[model samples]
Target: MIWDAVIQPFADFGFMRRALLGCVAISLGATPVGVFLMLRRMSLTGDAMAHAILPGAAVGYLVAGLSLGAMTIGGMIAGMAVALLSGFVTRATALREDASLAAFYLISLALGVLIVSTRGSNVDLMHVLFGTVLALDDAALILLCSLASLSVVTLALLFRPLVLECADPQLLRSVSGLSAVTHFVFLALVVISLVGSFQALGTLMAVGIMILPAAAARFWATGIGGLLIAAVAVAILASLSGLLLSYHYSLPSGPAIILVAGLAYGVSLVFGPAGGLVARALPRRHLEA
Candidate 1:
């Protein structure tokens, strides 16, 4: 009976199966990126970049009228621009990267909203904001698979440099001239992950899949390897639970998925084995003893 209730929707509907596959693919690609973001102390930067991609996507929607190819290209362009520009501004001027990123993302968001309003209706705007996960096509599936492959491969190649850069930027610079390349490549991966995930989770909520799972994992794991593994596992579990909840209760799939991630995050906060409230509190209790 439990199996039937939990497994019936996906078994009966092709859309449910596709949604699960898409979410799983996104989690695989995005969760590891999220780990690096967390380790780098740039979680909000990921959120800002997600917004920065909106203008390009909105412009694409305006020009191509819902063509996936156009929107994906536009979003990638805008996301990369914001990332590079923010990094450039920080290096070139006295301003901090976070401040510059905030300014750019705000402008980009306003531009996207204005463009979307001028060309499309509220329904169209909602689609851009919330996504159409249940309506994914073959093209979207192929794009998701391609992005997952690209992220996994690139991250593998850049792992050493990226870790060194994160752990000691000055040391990495002294030993290798590829620090800048590593930074840019990492930013590029962030852009790719965001743009690739936009179709399933939308620009607004896409970072949830990336950052939330990673945050939850941080409470449970000590090393980078463990953190990455835990994050991907948590994300896949959340995706499955969220999809099932959405199917049985008629909830919005994207938010449902995020909510599941959020729930996992909540549990981790209280009960995780590493840095959780319970774990931290235990140390205090021992000290008092």
Candidate 2:
């Protein structure tokens, strides 16, 4: 009965409700990961981890025949495997993170594509690159929620140590008992979050939202807590707005949300109050002496 006209899009139906909830969950869990990813200069690698989830999903679908539990387990394994490989290569050789990331994803993607083609489930390709949000069922919702909750806990407990390592790896290294090992483990968790969320936002756009909002937040804030708040707030608003726009216009939700986030990034670039273009260009703020 024109519920959207009266209420928010989030209340239009179970589908919209779950979609919004999923996005909100991701916003809370992934935004902080974005902050630390940026701090590590590994900002652009989230997409690879997302795409790296494809082969796992494919294997999951084939072996368990569309069971969400199996697919999640499979995808988690695949993501961890990729993260492990990247960590191993970086630790062993002179090759940098970018090179290792490229190698891992390219190979994993090729394998996934081949497997999916052989299984005659080409539609899964779309799910791999961009997930079907309207199709999510109760089980998937539960899984997403659980993962989000667990991630929040991990982030809370490890917040300080992770930051210390990100900001000053060498200094942290000198202290005995604390290894770069802990930092590597944390990055694996980040990859797991990306994989778990691949169904809602896809690999490409997931990284965009994950990294962009946090980046925009960093233009002004001095405190990590404040910056996290700014990023999470912006992410939630952008996600909900983007979802409503897409539903009304019959557009793809993933790209729509990412676009809104990209727009925020553009605005921040031009006018975000500190180091942004407009912030730098116009007259400085005048204060009474």
Candidate 3:
């Protein structure tokens, strides 16, 4: 029966179907964002923004009582605010990047929890920490898909400038003709990743959707395009497996999904085609020949 749960996640169950769709849609948006995050040294931005969405989402629920659309919009606003604050903190303080990131995630989460205390809703706080995939629905599916599509389209158009600016922010002034539009566009992509993934992974761990896969893919590929392809494939496959495993075993879906992604990252750490431990070790022996 446990095995059947894995194989049958796509069976006639509505919950299972929703989980699968969420996995697919999330990866579609997150993969490119993951690439950019990896390049920009802002991977934690996803994590920070995810937590920041919480207060807004909870407040929206207080106002409207579980209308997902309102809740999500609120979450998006909060996410945008977090992104801006992260940048502001980094700039205005002598604090290091990691310090600023920690401030954003921890403080925002505390604020969210405080607001939730006032709402009188029994919405499981644990469920927010680790999402409940079985509760997914058509409205969420549409929203996630639209966000993903917008992310992909915008990224494709701004790919070159974004990559260039990420490599050298100083080029903003030097490139005479190049607008710093790439920075704005990349922020927009991060927003979509946060918004699109919130329902699946919630505010706590959703950054895994935008970080783990890329981290894993780094071992297997060198070029940006190749790394992105590997990242997308790993994220989708892990998400698919994790959702099914969680549904069958009654585990928390979001963390379970992230665990799967982490496992993939571990695998790449040890066995990836390019930079795995084995790959580095193998070259030494061959050189001795």
**Candidate closest to the true structure, highest lDDT:** 1
Model 3, 1-289: lDDT tens digits are: 8556666667757788888887788897877798789878888776676777888787777788767787788787776676667666776888766777677768777888888886645554665555656788888888888888888888888887887787776776487455445655676578768767877787666789779999998998899998889899998998898887787788888888889999999999999978799888887544654
Q: Is candidate 1 or candidate 2 better by TM-score?
A: 1
Q: How displaced is residue 10 in candidate 3, in Å?
A: 1.0
Q: TM-score: which candidate is best?
A: 1
Q: Candidate 1 lDDT (Cα, whole model)?
A: 0.92
The clash numbers for all candidates, in the given order, read 0, 0, 0
Candidate 3: what lDDT? 0.78
All candidates' TM-scores? 0.97, 0.92, 0.88
lDDT of each: 0.92, 0.78, 0.78
Poorly placed runs, candidate 3 (over 4 Å): 1-7, 86-106, 176-180, 284-289
TM-score of 2: 0.92
Off by over 4 Å in 1: 284-289
Off by over 4 Å in 2: 1-8, 283-289
By descending TM-score, how would the candidates be arranged?
1, 2, 3
Worst lDDT window (10 residues) for model 3? 176-185
